[model samples]
Target: MWGLQPFYIPWYWYPCSTVFGSFFERWPLNKLELGMPRLGLLHTGIVLLLTLITELFLKQLGLDLFTTTTGPTFAAIWTTVGLGFVWQFNMWPFTELSQPTKGIVASIASLIISVFLYLVTVFLVGQENIIQGLYWWFNILWVQVFLMAPGLYDGISLWQDVPPLVEEQQPLSLNSEGR
Candidate 1:
């Protein structure tokens, strides 16, 4: 239970990017001397493994209770905080902390932010209406997240390398031998 994603999808990219992305950026992972390719692979692996483990943990424990009670187990807030850490604050105060400890601190901070946002929403909407037809919220959130998609940034960074399409005068090559 990735907590109310469409069809209860657990491997959703947003939450994984938000939580694991920031977590890995801290301490020991950041200290690694890997180049761009290796670092990217490591980041991908860390996010995937953690996301799978979290999905298993959530499903095993039936964390769906947070679904009806709170939206996506406050995943939206976690995304907000996680993105804020990197894009906005550049992971400030936590920068001073050591490796694993920094990661722990960042995790705790995100959790705190999630809880605080949850409380604020509950206070405003009241407990009774927490789950009442709020699907639109996530729909818009999806688009918002899409605009910030990591691939877009990568493409922008590598714009000079983007391949151009074949010219109309260039006939198609049907096979390896150019038959």
Candidate 2:
């Protein structure tokens, strides 16, 4: 299942992007503004927490769930929902576009990107080795890096806007003052 590897990437990446990316994006807005350092830490913490919860949920569901046909279908649906609704809504909270228009655009964009990833993965690996396929597909590093991108952007933006610290004047010396 060469296709399975790409499916796995988006399956993990999109949801993290939608949920964490959306919330992290708001850190720059007035409603949820935080200092850059704090925002970075908070973003890391949130990602870790979400990853932990997801791992626990999957573990509870058992490995057999992923080995079944239902696994891929469920993953596809999950990724679609994240990209279509969650990512779009979070990415464009203050857009002037109409709701339906935004939704259609988001859905199409998400579908295209997802399909492209799937095709690329399938083409590169070509369904030769199942073990390698599983390893490549299930790698968590891709998901972590994807989720960190927005935070890194936010951090850089915040860093640039920060005012430089001014040096404090030293008190006059008693000798210099002729005490």
TM-score against truth, every candidate: 0.51, 0.33
The weakest ten consecutive residues by lDDT in model 1 span: 151-160
| Candidate 1 overall lDDT versus native | 0.57
By summed lDDT, which 10 consecutive residues of candidate 2 come out lowest? 63-72
**After superposition, candidate 2 runs with Cα above 4 Å error:** 1-14, 23-32, 63-77, 87-179
Candidate 1: TM-score?
Answer: 0.51
Model 2's alpha-carbon lDDT is 0.46
Tens-digit lDDT track for model 2 on 1-179?
55663323234434544543533433333355677888668766665565455545554644222344323433443454433344334445434544445444654455455445444554666534434433554453346346634433341134566687987887677696645
Clashing pairs in 2: none
Q: What's the number of clashes in each of the models?
A: 1, 0
Model 2 residue 82 CA deviation in Å: 0.7
lDDT (Cα, tens digit) per residue for candidate 1, span 92-134: 7676876567767877787677567666766777667765323
